[model samples]
Target: MALVKVFSGSEILAQSLKVRIEAAGVNVIVKNNIQSSNMAGFGSLGQAVEVFIEDKDKEKAAQAIEDFKMGN
Candidate 1:
């Protein structure tokens, strides 16, 4: 199995946060997407998204994400 980077989860902050972070430089292949969990118009959050990346670039990938969040 490949590495799974949790960009977002059951929350918005976590969802976009992850994307902005990785998008800094590393390749962001949105594996899963954040969407409505169930059939309803009440709850909405990071449904589920997956992105693939080189194992070696994991560190850089993580940093890019952090920087993106910190607005660096």
Candidate 2:
């Protein structure tokens, strides 16, 4: 799979997305070079990162990510 987006906040969510996209192609491109969001001063930040895989896997990845966040 190819790297698509790089983000942080929760690797679990990222892993779930990668799992769902395994059937397709593309993945959350997390690397040392990925620019991180500045939330140090922010009160609450949900889902610090967002990724997009193949169009076909988009739906599956989304659901799996949600489930993962829910401890599924």
Top model by lDDT, which number?
A: 1
lDDT of each: 0.55, 0.49
Q: Residue 7's C-alpha lDDT in candidate 1?
A: 53
Runs off by more than 4 Å, candidate 2: 1-7, 10-13, 23-28, 32-51
Candidate 2 C-alpha error for residue 30, in Å: 3.2
Model 1, residue 72: C-alpha shift (Å) = 4.3
Per-model TM-score, in order, reads 0.41, 0.36
Model 2, 1-72: lDDT tens per residue? Answer: 433343355556665556655544435443321234343443435655555554454554665556655676
Every candidate's CA RMSD: 4.8, 6.5
